[model samples]
Target: MGADLYRDGVARLEAGDGREATRLLEAALREAPGDVKVMHALSRALDAAGERERSVQLLELVHAKAPSEPEPACELAMALLERTEDTRAAEVLAPVLAAQPDHPGANLCMAMALAKTDPERAKAHLKPASRSADADQRAQAAALERVLSGQSPG
Candidate 1:
């Protein structure tokens, strides 16, 4: 019912219109509180808008609601790492990787999660990430390789 607006909001978020997405998603959430998809999309919108902490909260709730789904786990893990909560990120991502090893985005994210604590191992995973068919995965893997080669990832 109300999810139509939420889905539209998600499309807006993906299109980089975070402000409009937030307004629409918030309106949807008000009507359909705790809808997992709505929460996930709105959380991503919040992250794109630079409201990182709030984004994490929305994603955490999503994870709680959908334990078997990997996207929210990936989102929360990256958000945690961005906030310097690497240990927590590892805790969340471990099961995800165990369940879906070939998920390119998850593997790339795992490599990033390991980069600060274990450079050599991260490089090994980053190699596969670079070869992944997904462009985003390849880009992340290449960025990691650049850093490992002693160049700035920037």
Candidate 2:
């Protein structure tokens, strides 16, 4: 039952129905407490639903449960960055960055966290993301580069 709910919730989330996804994911979590995959999916649904604080909490839980993995840390850092908590985001990312310096998502997020306070540092972080084969990541990196370079991105 929990797995079914989780699958449907993920489908909804991928289809851009975050509110429905959240409801189903919450039910999944209740049926399978402490399930990291469900928790991560719920965090993503919550984030899409604009429940950033809840997303952060769930991401934190997942990260705590699996510190060796970088996904939760990256998600948590991005969530913190969305909340304008750059320092906290940086703190969350520090270890991940140290362990996987070239991880594209981590680099992109670190760039975002440092963009305002240290444009040069952000530029360094953005380099790898810009070179990534993922078009979205490259676009984001390019946009950030424009912003840092005092030019408008369009």
Candidate 3:
């Protein structure tokens, strides 16, 4: 039951129906309380629904519960970066970056967090991210690199 709801909720979220996704994911969470995966999905749904604060809160909870997990840490760090909490985001991402220096997502988040204050470090991280298998990650790294080099991303 919980797994079904979780899949359905994620499907709805992917379908661009954040409100419905949130509803379904909320029910899924209730059915499987303390499930970090459900919590992560709900966080994404909440963010998609424009409930940014709630989404960050949920991400924080997920990070706390799964501190050593790269996914949750990266998600929470990205959320913090969106809020301009660069230092905190870097702190959150430190362990993951340490464990997997070439992790595309972690490097991207770290690059974003350090871009303003430390362009050199940001560029260093971007080097690995630019070679990511994920096109979007590579694009973002390229864009950030352009910005750092004083060229417009366009």
Candidate 4:
């Protein structure tokens, strides 16, 4: 039952129906409070619903509960970046980078965080990000690579 709710919540989130997604995910969380995936989904739904602070808070909870889990760390960094808290985003990615230097999401988020202040380092990070399965990440990595190479982003 909880898994069904989680799946429906994710589908609703992907469809951009964040309110319904949030409702479904909250129900899923009630059924399995320790489920990190449900928490992550709820956090994403909150973010999509414009509850940025709430989203960050939930991600933080997941991070605190599972410090060794990379998904929560990556999601938290992405949420921070979305809030324009680049420094905080970078800080959040630090441990993830230390634990998994080649973590694609961490590298991608770090690349965006450092792009303005450290183009060379950002380019290096983008190497892994460009290879990510997420098309948006790939596009951003490719565009940043072009920018760092002194060519117009194509």
Q: In candidate 2, what are the lDDT values of residues 12-95, reduced to their tens digit?
A: 999999999999999999999999999999999998999988888889999888754578888888878778999888878888
Candidates in order have lDDT scores of 0.81, 0.90, 0.92, 0.87
lDDT assessment of candidate 1 = 0.81
Off by over 4 Å in 4: 68-71
Q: Which ranking of candidates, highest TM-score first?
A: 3, 2, 4, 1
Top candidate when judged by lDDT against the true structure: 3
Tell me the spans in candidate 1 whose CA falls farther than 4 Å from its real position. 149-154
Write the residue-wise lDDT of candidate 1 on 65-117 in tens digits: 87546788888888888788877876776777777776666677777788889
- Per-residue C-alpha lDDT of model 4 across residues 1-154, encoded as one tens digit per residue: 9999999999999999999999999999999997888998999999899898898899998887776467778788777777788888787888878888887777988998887788888889998898889899889888888988899998
Q: What is model 2's C-alpha RMSD?
A: 2.3
Q: Model 1: what TM-score?
A: 0.80
| Better structure of 2 and 4 per TM-score | 2
Between 1 and 2, whose lDDT is larger? 2
Q: List, residue by residue over 1-154, the lDDT tens digit for candidate 3.
A: 9999999999999999999999999999999999999999999999999998999899889888877577878889887877799999999988888888889988998999999999999999998899899999999999999999999998
lDDT of 1 at 53: 83
Colliding pairs, model 4:
none
What's model 3's lDDT at 121? 94
What shift in Å separates residue 50 of candidate 4 from its native position after superposition?
Answer: 3.2
Count clashes in each candidate, considering only residues at least 3 apart in sequence or on different chains.
Answer: 0, 0, 0, 0
